[model samples]
Target: MASCTRKLYHVHGFDPRQHLEHYFSDKPDMVFEEDFLIFPIENLTKTFLEGHIRGDVLIDLSLGSMIHHLYAPSEFFKNIIILKVRDRCILELKRWLNTRTGAFEWGHATQLHINIEGKSAELQDKEGKVREAAQHVAKCDLDKQNIMDPVVLPPADCIISVFLLDCICKDQDDYVRYIRKFSELLKPGGHLILIGVINMTYFTVGKDKIHGFAYDQDLARKTVAAEGFVIDKCVTKKATGISDLVDHKGVLFIASHKEK
Candidate 1:
């Protein structure tokens, strides 16, 4: 199976601005509110905040925005390194992190995080925590044998990837190939948090429909297990209804670790 070409992804898919604005809002039409933010994101925040997992370096293989980690309990990981796939995504993140103009404001997401964690008004402080933890935003090439090339990174204590596997892959085998590649960054027994839209083949952005390899929970588990990870947690966010923005019946969150 072949991976989706990078040129296609850059041209039509993974628009950093649209991705940020659409999925990180509180509105019911926003998929984040209806499915993603409530279950998968909230579960992740609560689990990490509760001290269920501990780590030093958290490697982000998610090419999307860094808003997910902004809500997480920050004390566990001393630093975060986000490995991005596209240059535009990196620029978007850097713009926001540096507080530059034209960058989309993620304060709304931070506020939503505060409400979910039941914290008192301290949105800016939490934003700082995320920024502090994120020490690097480097470009990554899943096409490479070493995703982090020329500069090898120490195996990370935790690896988190959201909504990336399917889009970059052509089929189940292609997805597993990349999964195995990224897992190399994880220390043995380190945690892996992967979130994806379930049973989705393609998604729309503006006038274009970007393609993705559709997958379900069964294949998700089997593939990770084939890589020697033991699943510890699984959470699914069922879609309330259908929409053109995304085509998925549910979202799945998986927390697992390689066998030590």
Candidate 2:
């Protein structure tokens, strides 16, 4: 007799519209990215303003339907290239890039960044900066040796990724392998900024649960270091455990550079 078997859940990732509605709601309390992801970016911006992280080409890796965090970097970088894995995300982002209709409200994120970094109170100016700086938005192939296959994306001087790889990568090895690919996009000594939830096994979008690789600070530190990345700094923010919107022990921010 054949045995009954249960299939494992695959993390194909979440829909951009549902994700936006759930996480980026009008109620500030419901907004997760604005609260958790923006501060680390503020710190990055402060360093850039002080002439630390320099670059003409800044590559944003697999950022799904969210462009608010790029606000601070836009002021420093000459060009910004956004790459994504899914077609739905690309369409959502393109809608905003083209005309701003049907786009998730990003003004709060902009305001948060401005409040933290004092970039500017003018919301339109901040959005305009990022919109203007985003030179290209195209699909990426993380499975390939050259992830940015078609464009031959100019070796980035700095690359930023947030809450991207963890969900898409099926296992810890997958996570580490993609980091290597992410590093390959950088020029010698180029910086890498990674932001994600610590030990997050899954996140919820609507009624569905999106699975992700589980990891901690030690794993993060060891993997990046093992890949020959010089760890510049690491930061963490404690989660309040107030909401089950996503189950994460905490949030971790990592900054490192490929050795020169």
lDDT of 2 by residue, 1-260 (tens): 11122111222545787777676555656656534556555666665676677778999984468776687789888799998888888888878777667777777777777887764469888888888999688887788777766658798999988878767777779878988988888999999988877887777765667766788889989989998799887888776544676777777788889998
- Identify the runs in model 1 with alpha carbons over 4 angstroms from their true place: 1-13, 26-32
Backbone clashes, each candidate: 0, 0
Report, for every candidate in turn, its global Cα lDDT versus the true structure: 0.74, 0.75
- What would the per-residue lDDT of candidate 1 be over residues 185-204, giving only the tens digit for each residue? 88888888888888877766
RMSD of each: 3.3, 3.7
TM-score of model 2 vs. true structure: 0.89
List where candidate 2 sits over 4 angstroms from the true fold.
Answer: 1-11, 28-37
Residue 180 C-alpha lDDT in model 2? 91
Superposed Cα RMSD, model 2: 3.7
Q: TM-scores of all models? A: 0.90, 0.89
